[model samples]
Target: DATLLHSNGLTVLPTGTDNDITLFGPINEIAPDAGIFESDIAIRYFDGPASASCPTTTAAATLLRIEGDLIVPLGGPATSCILQGDILTVEYTDPTDASGDPNTVTDSATFDLRNGVLQSDKSVYIIGADMILTVIEPDWDRDNDGAETYDLDAIEWDSDAATVTMGNAGGEGAAFDPEPSSLRETGDSTGIFQVVIEIPNTLAGDKLERGEEVVLEYTDWGPSGADYVGDEDEDINLTIFTSNFGATVELDQKVYSWTDKVYITIVAPDHNFDSNLIDEIGNSAEDPIKVATRGTDIDPYKLVETGTDTGIFTGEVILTGFTAHDADGDGVEGDASGTTAGVGPTDGFLAADDDDGITVSFEFSEDETVVGSALIRWNIGEVQWLEASYPATGTGVVRVVDPDMNLNPEAVDNFDTDVWSDSDAGGIDLTVTETNEATGIFEGTVFFTVTDESSGHRLRVAEGDTVTAEYEDNTLPDPYTTADELDITGTSIIGTIVPPLERAPASGIRVVDAFGNSLGEISVDQQVQITSDLANGQDRAQAFAYLVQVQDDNGVTVSLAWITGSLTAGQSFSPALSWIPDAPGTYTATAFVWESVDNPTALSPPVKTTVNVI
Candidate 1:
């Protein structure tokens, strides 16, 4: 009996104790022409009788087709040529589904072209194309096993150009045979062939001139060596254009005041090559220009681009105030003049009338390119540039009157007092009393005097001349002093101390017995007296004593009593202290004087009265 098995192709054999069977038929057949002949084959089993048919039948197998078409799937019109340095792609597909699974059939491709002229080696195309070709292959099981796997492949374009080589997806050793003009079985499993070709500028010479056309033909060779063809030829055209760009800046006002608004315009010629206001080339709508004073230590201000018109950008930077100058060598301007303080006025003011005009500058930059310009303007001027000016003499007069030389209003006028006389003119002598240092207050006498050409007699102050007084306080204990110009006006000025000063009075204490008698010896449990007195001649008459201490023979001092009371000038206070001693010994008593409970003064001399306690 004869048997047939079906698979990708056909297979025939004899079975059932028919080892000596002779079978004649097609073994493997492909579409349209080759396949298994289901009826024509004859089989002879065991050499007994010749059988024209098989007892058992199997499925029929189909043939594998490896033919495909090459196509230029992407890029441009079929008649248009690609740019000199542009990319082109070629793909291949199967027309005949001979392999049953047409999508899984592997394929390859190759290109043949003249680098202007063909080379001696047919396989070597001398095209100065200097092309970089990348082949994308499908993942497949080359061994035809049940398990599917993939192999990394390499590509060699222009074997002479050692630098022009392509590595497989795994970047391992060469995956394709460089000797043959064939692409690897690389591509998706769709029986497709895909390859990208890049022509570098360095290789595209005058031979490939602008407006010239070049043709590239690619062929798709199936994995089984069957060839197919379709849109394999592609045309590439060359075109070129050059670019020239620059920029300039202009201001609405050449000279600006501190209160003025700075309007800036930037003209960038050829910035928009297409002449469209839109930012196509990324060169439009650049950063804003920086505006700053030429020689002032001020933070630079940015004039942001508010809008653009025909490649011209407009921006504005509003100046709130101008930088100050230390004209009087005091480290700050207008401090003594009361012109600009705190946030300062937006109206700019020069230190003096003769000062030079301030120079304002504008700076523009993009990337590494930069440009700048400057203009001079006065603080007070017309729309145009001008210098500041002031009068030679002031119009207001200033004087210091009602001098409290002794800091006492009730005292009569004394000849030795440092008094200020009513003066009309020439400079006056001013004095500052010694400051309390602790309270930060002082009194001074200002003598208004005038000079004469002949007699040098006293004169009254004239109008238009001003005298200003300034003071400095040493707030930080003994070292640092911060000065400030006092804002004073009118004829009489009286300044008071922040914390009033106090004078410690002279005090003395006397120790006496409790019986109102002067006793030398006293027994334990007996009482004694401590008398505290304030002298009449002292600056202050009142005095206070807070503590009274008693010392025994062993030299151990104990606080016998605590007194918190005040005493008037020439007044005496006698307080009874009864600190009974447990042991027989001699004891002495003393008192402590304090200017006030909060302010402590020197302790008064101890007034001792010896007593024997037994």
Candidate 2:
């Protein structure tokens, strides 16, 4: 039986050319960090004499990792030694194997060293997107280090070494050859040479399309007049990665007043890898987008790019409401309007009204088009209670939105509204005011009273009564968006229900400060108020006695305090009594509500809680 260790001796990276074969492994892959460095790992020319690229009989590997490809160079533009029989061998020894002696392991794989190799280094080639492919010439490494690196200025190129002839090899392959394109070196004599091939749409003419296939082939068959020795060639079969294009439309706001401007935005894709169509969009031969609302076209209002290269476009128009204010309606879209608004696109104009959707659309490459639409709506308002329930004595908070009144916040308009209650037909007439200028959110706080009618700060309400607040905008039509809605007269209603008499009067004790904030624990001799929420839920007022008692661990009452107060109908009030803990000990504080101190008539349940003094 053979002992197994965690080392993985051989693995090759995928990128290959005639020049190099990269192996990046043989570490203890199962180790904590996939790294167990050992000096035994080595690389060699499988079974050949030591050549210029290899030093000793066995050159073991040192860079052991799955990352950073460790390239092992092979001599060839097409070296005869690079035949199917030629191979690179890697070996490693694991001294820690279960076997008492050092265990040796070996692995090998064959790689290609082509004469003329094509390298794009991209997983995808998007059509209409420009890309560069490189052609590497033969390589020679006299230094016995398996890496294709020449001395400071080892190999250089100054002129055209060979002509590259490109042709299509899709569908039925044929001998249809086009004019030859020259292979340009990136710099002087840097073996890496580049060639530019245009896709069917952009720089490349009518040679490609969405569904069809386009094959690009470049060959250097003969040893030519270049800086290197042998000739190389490559066949690259590419399936055009075509994409269906589309766009989206949005408005600043869905609804608009008769005089409000409509802000429009359009985001369309140009079917390119990166946003390279900035030069063609926004200021294209024709308007990139079209806008229409009331059954007619509106001037495209010189759409502009949203950013340096975002492909998103935006344009704004003053809603001049009419098919055209005069006979100017039937004019053309930006077909006649200049590309800039400063100069004025006087011919084409669009006026929007509360009608069908405002449509903004654009056609992209091919006949594919994208359309975005939104309807112009009536400026109706909305009303909502901050919370649906509140005690009759607590404040009722309502938020109002009246586009007609809130539309202009710089003036900070305050509009009168009504908050009526079920208990009384007549209620408080409240005026709502604005706070945040940008959102124009109007809020009105009304202190609800049981039987008193109050102004801005008061709305008469009762226990279990429904408080209704209706903010009406007379500019909106009752049947909104109708032809009769030329006027805004919509009503927004919010009805809040006061908490009912779910339970009778109750009292509870909490050690609190002067501000009624609970003091979770008290120090010895600390004077704190024991408070209770005393409330009356009757149709008539009631006199109540609130009492608090503290008992020590011995069950003897150490402190007792009481208060008498009158609670109006549906009124919630708090009463407090002072208590001083004389010593550090465990105590329980209990509160009780009764008819009076003399008449011990319990009106509700008494509440008790344990308190710790530290």
Candidate 3:
């Protein structure tokens, strides 16, 4: 259009004829419309010195202006105005990201804002608790100045009760109206108003139920009654919550064997209100959780928080089967049964049998309790002998197969059994354990030990005696016996005296020629026999290792051989290993005997002789 001069004197910095700034005719103009108008403004510089900042250029001088036309429809100024907020964007190069294009960011000082905003401090409010519904009217503070929540003199409520309709979520319950004049200011001149709604907790008279929703609807009214809506309404939806432990317990495995470690996980939503993971419940202290093999005698177990703000807890408990008599029958056992707590690992020692039930419970609060259960089964265990029979001086190997037993490859799962001569009934206690949890096979060594003066677990018996190994399966009930035995007869049926071997070498070794003769002289390309005359000098059969080594004149071994087998009582044998000579030289032959190749213990002094390989 055209430029009309107004008396608001606009001036430049220096007041002079050459420096004074003059108004120019408009290049583009805007007429108030329904939508926002945007454009840029520029200043035309005339007759500027030619320097590095700006080079001399002869361009036509012009001016331009950019603006967003504002329009208020509710009323005129003083009564209502548009709450406008804008963002000035900029793009610049960042040294840290040189290879990428220029980075763009929003101006932090400014953000988007609007009117008729409604919100609450919390998402869900517990039933029977106090709730505050906040309302923000940007038009009330359009000038950015503060306004009170309740203005008695203003025609805001029309001198009548403000009807803010409160209803259940999804229209589940009947609409309930809050108290009259419930509107109040949240802060001084904050322009934020809130209506405090008191929720009833009494189940008998309470109109709201757990899992229900709460909706707040508020409409502004001028001189009209609160029932009249001046414009669109502002509303918010929230949830009605209930307080309790509400935790779920899960066992890592559905089935477990005796003496196995039970892993437990408990997930309780909203349990930890704080952001930190330090919060705890049903812990070792306060109200300690218990996982008992029986119903009455609950044992204290340890549980800890899994992570920050997770509301999840994890723990591990060891099951003591019937052998340990760790159970809490049908009665109350640990502090889990009480309203308070107790210092404990487990108070009740009630024995648990196979197919017994395990009780896990905790006291979340004095009024609330959480309980869970699992199954404990211990099958009838069976034992197997590594051999059919054993000599009086031989060791016995007992392998127990019990799926009800927790097997650990690391050899931690261990249990005790007994073996004795059935004739004398003098039993010796032995420890058997599982290796390789996948296969529930346990093995232990039963040595034929000597009769020491003081005896605790000593089984001294001669040949022909029947050794009975009894596996006490505690899983069996009282009416049924728990003893399962395996009777193994001694190697000899006549009670004879067999030979016994030492832990190390008991005889000497020697080397012989290929024809089984003493080493003397051997021709090139001829092989010589190296042998050791070993005998079972004791009562029992013993394992033996015989070795023969042939070396050159410089003491470097050129040939080596060995023979391994068992030597029975009073048995004599000669083991020979051969060595061939390739070159004509003075070769030395040496033979040695040991307990076994695995153990290089010299059973006898090594003997050597020289051979002429020519």
How many clashes does each candidate structure show, in the order listed? 22, 16, 21
User: What is the per-residue lDDT of model 1 for residues 1-614, given as tens digits with 9 covering 90 to 100?
Assistant: 55543222333444553332223433344455654323322111111222232221111101101112211112212222211222223233545566654343443333222111111111211122222232322222122223222221332223211223333442322332222233323333432223323232222122222222232222222122111112132222122211223557666655443323345566653333222233222222333333444333222332323333265554444333322432112355432121221111122222211111233232322343444443433221101001111111211122222221112222222111112223332333334332332111233434323343211222233222233332221111112222322222233212111112222232444445655666556666655565555332322245555566788777798546766665544444554454655666877666555655576664354455565766
All models: lDDT?
0.33, 0.52, 0.50
What TM-score does candidate 2 get on C-alpha atoms? Answer: 0.41
Query: What is the alpha-carbon lDDT for the whole of candidate 3?
Result: 0.50
- What TM-score, computed on C-alpha atoms, does each candidate reach? 0.23, 0.41, 0.37
Q: Model 3 over residues 177-219: C-alpha lDDT tens digits?
A: 3333444555555666676554443322333433444444434
- Model 2 lDDT tens row, 1-614: 22322223343333332223433345444556756554323332332333444333222223222324443433322222222234657677888788678898998875434355556544344455544655665432222323232221111111121112332323111121111244454554455566544433422223233433333344443223321222243333322343344556677876654334456666654433354444234334333456666655653445656664576766665433432211111232221111112211222345544444566666544555567666654456677777767777788677876544433323454666667777655776677787655244678887877767665567666665777776654445336533222221222222333233222366555779777788888898788888777677665567888888899888999988898888877789888889888888789888888778998778777888777887
Model 1 quality (TM-score): 0.23
Q: Which stretches of candidate 3 lie over 4 Å from their true place?
A: 1-114, 120-136, 140-209, 221-247, 252-264, 270-307, 314-355, 359-372, 382-416, 420-427, 431-469, 477-614
